[model samples]
Target chain A: MAGMNMISAAQRFHAYANPARFMALSARLLMPLAALTALLTGAGLWFALAASPPDYQQGETVRIMYVHVPSAWLAMMGYGVMAVASAVALIFRHPLADVCAKSAAPIGAAFTFLALLTGSLWGAPMWGTWWEWGDARLVSMLVLFFLYLGYMALWATIEEPVRAARAAAVLALVGSINLPVIRYSVVWWNTLHQPASVFRMDGPTIAPSMLLPLGLMGAGFTLLFVTLLLVRMRAEILRRRVRNLRLAQAGGAGEV
Target chain B: MTRAFFALLARDLRLAVRLGGGGGMAVFFFLVVISLLPFGIGPDRELLAKVAPGMLWVALLLAALLTLDRLFQADYEDGSLDLLTMGLLPLELIVVAKALGHWLTTGLPLVVAAPLLGLMLNLPGEAYPPLILAMLAGTPALSFLGAIGAALTVGVRRGGLLASLLVMPFYVPVLIFGVGAADAATGGFAGEAGRQSLLLLGAVALASLVLGPLGGAAALRANLR
Candidate 1:
């Protein structure tokens, strides 16, 4: 189902990719996406704060899951977005794929920073320590954060647009291995962090009370990411257009 | 095809020895880093002995990382990389050859020198063989993985620092298992944990052997284009 959704999404990306058409479609998308994000965020907050019962063991502190878990999930998902777009850029030579990959990097890095910050926040009361060196998941996630910074640095250092895109595309593809490592670190080591309860094989172990709010928050975060992504991609396109125009003007001036 | 690969390998090996300051500088850098640890961390013999394995692996990583940009940047500047790319041998194979040359020059010397330096830290007598074994198995991975970053930033000016930043994250797992294997010998070399660490370290090196060439080749092509 995920694979199917990705293929269709990629098709939509390839279909109306003429920049003028994309701008029109994305402008239409912005308001609806923002509205949906707001709606989900409000409902999710209400349920998480008021409706969801506090854990008998964890008390009110478990509520941090509303922010922490979703941030972690979306952080990984953002990397997936970058990797997939990088592949499209490399293989299909889709005009917008590099833009998409470039746009996803800072947003993904922000989410990763959020995940680490919230995880540290959650850990303070839960584990009695702000950080745990013993935990593989935390360590791997830290590595992922650094990887994101490095990927962005690569793009920044390479001046030529085409060269930067291809070099960064390759780096993104290589760093994609981090996704699986972070996902499985909890399962493989099972250190201080709790094992994955929601995405398990025997069905979600959590009761209906908390899962509902978690799902809502997760949906809200995904929508927010897509919204932010569209805004950033539009900005990148405009930036490139401005650069090209300046170059053109300078060339004409030199000729005159 | 095989002849071309070996020729490239031989040429690189020669360059490393004759033109690129040889592998002597990396070993000397390794010694300096190891020597500075006592001053930096304070002269606590017990602590130095305890943390020697991890410290040694770290020094090895830094030394190898420092030399990585030289792998392709020289050929790139001299326009020889273009020749290799145009030759009959695939770029992936060329990457593999250069990576091997890198390992032979840099990684091998460090592995040989690691034991002598361990003695400076009052390292456990039992740890020597395991430390050598671990480095022997793991250091090639550092070279191979470093090739990817070297290739990525090949055409960029003064890209050594950037390549190091990019390659450091990829070096984590290798460092973990290498230090694990080297340190575990304290509990007796026969411990199951040491064996597992060495095995995993080897597995990582093998995986990098495959992935390194492929990624490095792709990055090289991108830069060359």
Candidate 2:
């Protein structure tokens, strides 16, 4: 039954919350994840730039959409992942949750930065301005970027890992709740940005030609997030191991 | 439980007033910030009047930030927060009490002082009532929401700046509706233009009232662990 399969899936998730298990699993996943990411990136880029037709109105500047839209989606997606990790860390005391959340911050920030940069570049040609405050999506994205910065800053400011993890988890949850409010506020206020075209109530308004490139680029970016997260989480685990080893060595010398 | 809450509230109020320069520092900062705006923006009375709602709200937010670190940091530093956490009353009540104390001390004064500052900015006479009403309805939300940031950063040394960075984004909704309400009041649109924004501001305040204490308490407990 489907319910039995769901239970097993939950079991697998809980099993991997163990750091040693997570380390071994992620090591296995990393190679395939990286290979898939590279393959997707190459194919996605080729299709987006070479195969997909340019926008009738936007012309070649629309190529930026291949990068911009996907990065923006990943930026939001990355925060969602961090928020879930925080929730898991708080509720289950999962050993790997904090590491997962912490490792994702810089990657999220980078994607957010890329989204903004590509957005500006796109806007400069299309809208005849480098930036537009009247755009709700852009403004909301900016706020999201600031949230990432604040989250990272909190982690840096606190010296104790346990204390920092808890505080950051609480913050991440609060930010997640506030995200909708921020988005709503921007939308309620005046915005010059075009309304949603891809994700709509009935169906996507975008043409299939544009949609194909967008979909491929989205998948590629998501794979990259997975590859980067695994690598960063592994590095974090090793750093903790080194710190623990150093402490044990110091304790041994003191015993003499 | 109610008595315990009130007692904690009173204790925080007294401490903020007595030791922390009588909660006047925030109002003073608010005053100074308003005074400096004319110099920076070049003293155009019309422009000042036009932007007064936003300027006042932004200054109020910054002034509120000046006092936020004091919300939990003092108790945190003196080991009292740990004791409070272990006390009979729940940590959530303590958070509510502290945020209420912050509102009473800092937020109320800023609301009280806004009309006077509004005059210097040449804010239209019709705008004053809504502006005051908006601030009164909205500021408790700021205090409560800010307490969460204060609690999160309480374990860090000299975390005042980080607290502001963490807390200010949360203040955006309040700022938007607060400014909107003031604008509606001044824009002279007929049939309750200002009323809608004020009502929305109240809704946001209510949501924050429920969420802030819970979130702040959770952060405090986490830090204590």
Candidate 3:
């Protein structure tokens, strides 16, 4: 049964590798995904804002973690997806992979911006400063924010689609190498900020009461990301098609 | 192959010296940036001393970036890069040669000028050697890493700013270690403490020296196509 499932999964992937099929499949999935996103996010917010207990030490301000942490999570998650998509685009030259990467940049940048803004909001009350250079995680988030901006900027600056994708892919791969360094630089330089709590080796340190809400929020954000990615990818595919059509109309110029 | 490598290196070095105020402009920009910092932040020498190491590294890094536009733009525009790409020498070697030339003309001057700027900033007497040493160890990595950004942005119009944006984040590790080494020396940590940061700085440079050329070569191939 497990082997049969794997074969079906592969077949599905192969089928959707075609753009027309992908458009149809994503269009079908979009409504269900959107419904799930709304359901999960509404529940997640209720649990986070109303049900979860305030922290013992941080009091009410700790409530900010729900919005802040999940956004940060989505920010990094979005970049990881872009990097993987870029790698696939580079190695396999898949048309969908290029669209996947290009469509993902702005979304990743938005999430990264949200993470920075929400993190600052969380920090102002908790850390007593609006910003702290001594905090490794926040500092790394800022660097990651810049990385996203550069990636998007590269895409915007290049006019040719294929050339842009290849160039942006190289930049994406190189920038990913620095992501870990940015994460660790504070430790190497001696951090004044808190160590990681949720994603630790020995399990999260937060209470179960808070953890459940955080988990729901995380799932909701991820589902929302998937919904948005499908929407954007479909739009990008259509945009490229329009460009090809226009080019063809203009004296049946060069190949698309 | 050996002779061709050195020949490329020699040719790049000659061009950097002969044209466009290459070495002098970068060092002068480094000096101006550091000098302007005192006015912007005030001339409280103690505060200046406190921030001096980091400021020096930041200035040198920017100075190196300013010179990087010339690294490939000239060769690219003159059609030599296309010839080089099609030539007997590998693209990675050419990247390495360009980075080496960039270091000699740009990185070396910053290393030499750092101590003078260090004095102007009222850096502690004990900090001078480590500041100079750290810059010496770290600036080569800037050139090498900057090469990848240069290659990636070569085909774009007015790509100098974009290249810096793409490249600046990568400089974080180098900055951290470079400043850390100087701070360790000035803070009077144990005898080996400063050495550790220096070693790490060297390690970063060595790693960049190896990986940067390959990445830059790949970017050049992609962008040139």
Interface RMSD of 2: 13.2
Worst 10 residues of 2 chain B by lDDT: B16-25
Extract clashing residue pairs from model 2.
Answer: none
Worst 10 residues of 1 chain A by lDDT: A194-203
Ordering by lDDT? 2, 1, 3
TM-score of each: 0.51, 0.52, 0.52
Q: lDDT of all the models against the reference?
A: 0.83, 0.83, 0.82
Give me the displacement of residue B196 in model 2, in angstroms: 50
In candidate 3, what are the lDDT values of residues A126-189, reduced to their tens digit? 6444444435566567667667877876776577899999999999888888788757754454
Superposed by TM-score, candidate 1 places the C-alpha of residue B95 at a distance from the truth, in angstroms, of 40
Give me the TM-scores for chain A across all models, comma-separated: 0.85, 0.88, 0.86
Candidate 1 displacement at residue A251 in angstroms? 1.1
Quote the positional error of residue A176 for candidate 3 in Å. Answer: 2.2
Tens-digit lDDT track of model 2 for A34-111: 999888888899989999887776778888888988999999999999999999888766778899999999899899
Residue A81 miss distance in model 2 (angstroms): 0.6
Kindly provide the TM-score of model 2 when superposed on the true structure, using C-alpha atoms: 0.52
